[model samples]
Target: MRATIAPQDPADNSDWDVDGSPPDVVIKLSCPNAQPAPPSEEVESFTPAWTQGACDVLSTDLLSAPIQFSVIDVDALFDDPIVSVQYQVTRADIDRGVMEFTGSGALRSVAFQLTTYYAE
Candidate 1:
């Protein structure tokens, strides 16, 4: 699934920079081999840790400004579910763009993962 940035946070926002320059970037998440059905409650609880790790990895790059991640789509195939998550990083959030992890079991398998996209 492909998720485009919302109009409210268009990719061309001039203000999306700390140094008055927009970073060329795009953020994407894919769960290709994920189980079709939701993971058990026990397994679901560990999602936060996984998200935290991803956030840490994303934040390490100084080029990319921190952006918040949001769920944009989810497709459940016969074997695995294709989850598409999106994030929008604004200039305003650059300074305060701390990585945050959030998920919902009801949506199935800790749906909705997000992080900021930065320039390479």
Candidate 2:
């Protein structure tokens, strides 16, 4: 039920920074039914290895709302998107527990897992 984000290279990925430095990276996951989830801890790296981020949606809500996954460069005044994608949850997705979807913009790889439970 943990998720990870690792940015790739400029030739293959994107240079999300503008100041000739590595971007201050954070992961964002949002859903229409809920307020935006809090941002993950900031890291300064062109290729950052971040894990167990702060973005997740309830299994029950997955079908009703789309989930947005974003990689952002956190700035003092504003944040810029590095890569973002909105995913529609399918019944198969919940059943599989792990999912991989196409990335938006310059990136090309994105995958994550979600844990689901049952209650009676």
Candidate 3:
């Protein structure tokens, strides 16, 4: 499955240059009763950015699982998460091709694509 994530305009962009430094972007995903996918790729020191990432999940029944996405900032030595959201996916949503969601408060909006087949 693939998820394209980024900060949603003003809320996420407003603090782009926090303390005169760019925010390091990180995305994470998890599913209940299944091994979590490796954290998504990170773009170091970015401001108001978007990222496309994919993970290979081995679960046989993804429809029953709720996938969670978390967006965070990687600081000098710690990770500060901006938003975290979870959705219980169905086969229909995956077939639909595109789905959108948002994080709490200042977390950015996220768009994701689901597919059972992968193209090399």
Candidate 4:
């Protein structure tokens, strides 16, 4: 699978150092039934992690098992949770071409664009 991630944090930049210093987001995935997905991505504020490829869903119960996306800030000294969201991927959505979704956490929201197949 391929996906894009974007930060929808509060627009107030007064407290943030806007000279290209924003929280670097680390994207991680987990499923109830297998080893975690590989090639976790990192994205900057408002910047999308574009079209990440080749995610294999190994669970037998693909519909019932949830796929979780965890967003973390890598710039922090310690582990910081920015957002955690989960959705069950169904075969119908996969065959429909592309999927778009959004999720909100305590600090901000995120927008995602997903595609299973790679194309020019």
Task: Please list the C-alpha lDDT of all candidates, in the order they appear.
Answer: 0.29, 0.63, 0.57, 0.52
Which candidate, 3 or 4, would have the higher lDDT against the true structure?
Answer: 3
Better of 1 and 3 by lDDT: 3
Candidate that beats the other on TM-score, 2 or 3, i.e. the better one: 2
Error of 3 at 26 (Å): 0.7
What is the per-residue lDDT of model 3 for residues 4-101, given as tens digits with 9 covering 90 to 100?
A: 33433244455544575555667777755555667666665433333445344433455657778777767666666666777887666667865566
Question: Order of candidates by TM-score, top first?
Answer: 2, 3, 4, 1
The candidate that wins on lDDT is 2
Tens-place lDDT per residue, model 1, 1-120, is 112222221323323233333222222332222212222221111122222223323333423433333332111322112233444443444456442334332122332233444438
Give candidate 3 regions above 4 Å deviation.
Answer: 1-17, 32-34, 44-53, 58-60, 117-120
What tens digits encode model 2's per-residue C-alpha lDDT throughout 1-120?
222334433434644555656678777777655657676778786545456553455667777777887877777787766677788878898898877665434445556666544434
The positional error of residue 101 in candidate 1, measured at the CA in angstroms, is: 8.0
Query: Per-prediction TM-score, please?
Result: 0.26, 0.64, 0.63, 0.59
Tell me the RMSD of model 1 versus the true structure.
16.3
The better candidate by lDDT, 2 or 3, is 2
Model 4's lDDT to the true fold? 0.52
Candidate 4 regions with alpha-carbon error over 4 angstroms: 1-20, 50-54, 58-60, 104-120
* Candidate closest to the true structure, highest TM-score: 2
Which pairs of residues collide in candidate 2? Answer: none
* Candidate 4, 26-61: lDDT as tens digits: 667665565566645665654445445224543244
Off by over 4 Å in 2: 1-15, 32-36, 54-57, 76-78
Clashing pairs in 3: none
